[model samples]
Target chain A: MSQFENVSVVKQANVYFDGKCISHSVQFADGTKKSVGVVLPATLTFNTGVPETMECVAGACRYKLKDGDWQSSRAGESFSIPGNSSFDIEVVGEPYHYVCHFG
Target chain B: MSQFENVSVVKQANVYFDGKCISHSVQFADGTKKSVGVVLPATLTFNTGVPETMECVAGACRYKLKDGDWQSSRAGESFSIPGNSSFDIEVVGEPYHYVCHFG
Candidate 1:
């Protein structure tokens, strides 16, 4: 821990998905909030009340925006999800790493 | 830059899997060799001439040894493969994060 003696910021996790995914909710010094999560392969659905931007940081995934078609998204690809709606994700062959921004 | 004022360590990557996974090869102050790789869902093979202790840091995976059964590995789990042999990894429904320690 002393290696990071100068780093006062420690990442904290707020949610865990059976080790398949982990969400670390970060609150910046100015109190802005963002969540970074690592998602493994699987078909999972999420309901949101706040608009969110999901950024694929590592792997790939196909997401269906409510009644929308499943679109292909690769690493570094991103999509937006509306508030009061839900989205479905089909994790592809590899782990799908992502960061979600919410307001 | 000033955020990690106490952290002198900077992660460097020697391999990148199309941004699906990234490996940060860490060389300790004592000259130890280890590779930390985040693997997105994929079926990949690796050949190693040195012994490695593959530790799952985040996700899960199934690895098959030489003529061995496909064993399930989850988060915080690990398996060792002999030197000079190759192994197959079928990344399941998530990212397979790993830390490989070598001599």
Candidate 2:
């Protein structure tokens, strides 16, 4: 069996969503597997005024809304929108990394 | 509606497991809700020799397996075990934190 098949289902990794988010999975050296979705800076926005949300899968990030209001989020933080809100977000300083899933 | 009812189902948070791990959920300031499982050092062990695992929901941690061999895990990392393995983990320095669910 592949590494994924050996381990019991301990937990599912977190997922984040953006227009250009990419999905991928990895198996650690100790036979653990993590599946994740990633959104980069270039593809962080959508044309419609949809709310973008993410859960910190592994790091910290600073985010902002319409003007320049900022907020910091760490792993396990989750957010969402109702499909008719306007928002913009960027990684605080380094690359913005999170696992995401969208509707 | 409560904040949990307002946000769309963005993504489910990760879960970790140890025998005495406790489960809890929280809603953040921006109307975001985060559900997490906490395993403090006191109740972190089991008598049946089951494997203990955690996903770094927010910060960083250093862990050791059988004999003080150390490994560092950041957020997004996931691990699991069959019903018969043995292991031990610590938060490195600060309090250990993670969101978890179990079967």
Candidate 3:
């Protein structure tokens, strides 16, 4: 996917996950929150409070939706995870650059 | 700083610094490159080819311009690095969150 254009950023925040990942949160004018983060070569499970759309800005990863099959996403690719559910993401070698949008 | 704001992202890129820092590069609609990144708790020096204005998005870090004073900047703060010069950034407790503007 391309960059997010014409976005009004309101606030920024940092998220820590021990030494696994650190995501920088971006809050926009329309009350939407997005995070640009890097996930190292590890497998992680994330629980979302809101529906999230994750875009692979760089690198690649594999994911399995709740009770679904594992799929892969590369640079400029995207996937959607339903809110209140969880998904598993696994990465290898290169740390993945991701842009996550919550709605 | 709170968030970035209305931004049109044309492309997303990843920047690496060995293991010290990893930044996700956001290329905006007007051709500006802004990186939202995390600096591990280490002192690293960077050389810039263009004038850079760095905003502290989260945590804090100490920096000194070329032959300048060493100063600390917390979240919601910012510093500028001149073109063709270098700056030293030191982080101790927390990884510093930064938004760097390049011109």
Candidate 4:
């Protein structure tokens, strides 16, 4: 039940991969932005525009960075992706919940 | 783009109906709670313990409240459901984005 307090959140969701992934953008008072999102049980590839740190809030995901081996990240775990790069993520059984930090 | 300011948002999403509908809980400074959510293209039934007002933020939905006729609610429109009641919503084409106010 971790939450982001005293922040601004966009009402509309960002739906990707035909709704397999959905996220809401939140902005802090200091102008930092992050996304709280979920990836349904599916394997998907995502391209990053800026550097991002994906923190698992609940559930789990197995991710593979560009030219890297697959690694599992569960609740309380995290993985980073370089800007202008891409990654593949596979979620099974349950949804993958995450907080994505942008830089 | 409409946004909620100075609020707390739950990091984990509320996934319902096998991920057909997803929402994030948001709490205001005064303790009021709402959910920003999206319903994918599907027909789903939802039961409520408390009264709720569903405000469409994007896309559209045709809803039937209990024994009422099906009605359309698009962006900027809202529909209310009585406490201890159930409603059926059908979304087609694009995902239906909404803000659900509970009381």
Candidate 5:
């Protein structure tokens, strides 16, 4: 069996976003990496009016919806965004680390 | 939302296991608690000959199988145990935190 066959631990890494926070990449811990960029950070919102799923691993943030409703999340919190909509967010403190999976 | 809606963060709590090392409980973070004890820790082993699923949240431990092959796990690691078997474990460091779900 592979070294990871019985392992479920995934390490976290940092990414550099240049003003535009939209990009995608397949990160592997085994020294191999793949790049896939087709989304925009500004256009990719969640928990407010965006169609996406976001999980917060650290820090906090506020998501403002198009209809004026807002949601807040802190470290260890997760939120689900409905499809066919968009939203905005402001980092509450420090740089936030989130995992976003989109369709 | 009932404060738990849209939140995926689960807080960890300490469990006091007697020398027997076997107990069951449904732990909730919302001030509610449930207790279920029907399994023996000595008979509920994993990754070796135990048919149980185990997750390591903190510290490290080693599982020595009956066949002499052993498995080790550190913090943040998780492993699945096959069904109908049992194994033994030895904590390597400080008290370890693990979550076991059985059928």
Candidate 6:
């Protein structure tokens, strides 16, 4: 869906990479937490504490997992990153919009 | 409150001024709309279509409404702008986080 319904959204944003990446936390009634975020034109490395699935909502990105080749993810696509791993994401031209689901 | 509960939030963000300002739209069941956003350290001008109340969630900014003196809004504080008017906001050091209430 284009939007999440019946959820709780935190007012403050989580800024990363000196504002190149910004996200707002969203909490579900069932205790599941997600984040809607955007990555502006930049290449950044991110480490994940928990297993995460990055679902692309708009724009596009090329991401690489540890020891893996870079792969593209566009709108309506998703990529998974294992817990305790790091990934590098590259965005250019347009900002990459995503919904990050955590487990 | 620090968060909005039982609301719908769009997945994508509204990027303005080449990503200097970013916001996500939140919808209430009552059909009211608000935005949770952050502005990176920069000076920017914004024009409002509807009256808006910008509630600071974190950081701070100095703002000047049309024909008004510059004023500061910090965390836990708020400032308002009239509809069809413009305002200048200056943020330094840190990104200014806000929840924008519309009327």
Q: What is the DockQ for all candidates, taken in turn?
A: 0.13, 0.02, 0.45, 0.96, 0.01, 0.96
Which regions of candidate 1 deviate over 4 angstroms?
A: A1-12, B1-103
lDDT of 4 by residue, A12-73 (tens): 99999999999999999999999999999999999999999999999999999999999999
For candidate 4, the lDDT comes to 0.98
lDDT of 5 by residue, A64-96 (tens): 656767788776686666777666776642444
Q: After best superposition, candidate 2 residue A81: deviation in angstroms?
A: 2.6
C-alpha root-mean-square deviation, each candidate: 8.5, 15.0, 3.3, 0.8, 16.5, 0.5
Candidate 3, residues A1-103: lDDT per residue as tens digits? Answer: 4555566543343444543566656655666767777777789999989999998878899999999999999988899999999999998888777888887
TM per prediction: 0.47, 0.29, 0.76, 0.99, 0.31, 0.99
* Positional deviation of residue B68's Cα in model 4 after best superposition, in angstroms: 0.2
lDDT for model 5: 0.42
The local distance difference test score of model 3 is: 0.76
- What fraction of native interface contacts is shared by candidate 2? 0.00
* TM-score of model number 3: 0.76
Tens digits of per-residue lDDT, candidate 4, B1-103, equal 5999999999999999989999999999999999999999999999999999999999999999999999999999999999999999999999999999999
TM-score of chain A of each: 0.81, 0.44, 0.85, 0.98, 0.53, 0.99
Question: What is the TM-score of candidate 4?
Answer: 0.99
Q: How does each model score on lDDT?
A: 0.63, 0.42, 0.76, 0.98, 0.42, 0.98
Q: What lDDT score goes with residue B69 in model 2? A: 67
- What TM-score is obtained for chain B in each of the predicted models? 0.80, 0.44, 0.86, 0.99, 0.52, 0.98
Query: How many residue pairs of model 2 clash at the backbone?
Result: 11
Alpha-carbon interface RMSD of model 3? 3.0
lDDT of 1 at B43: 81
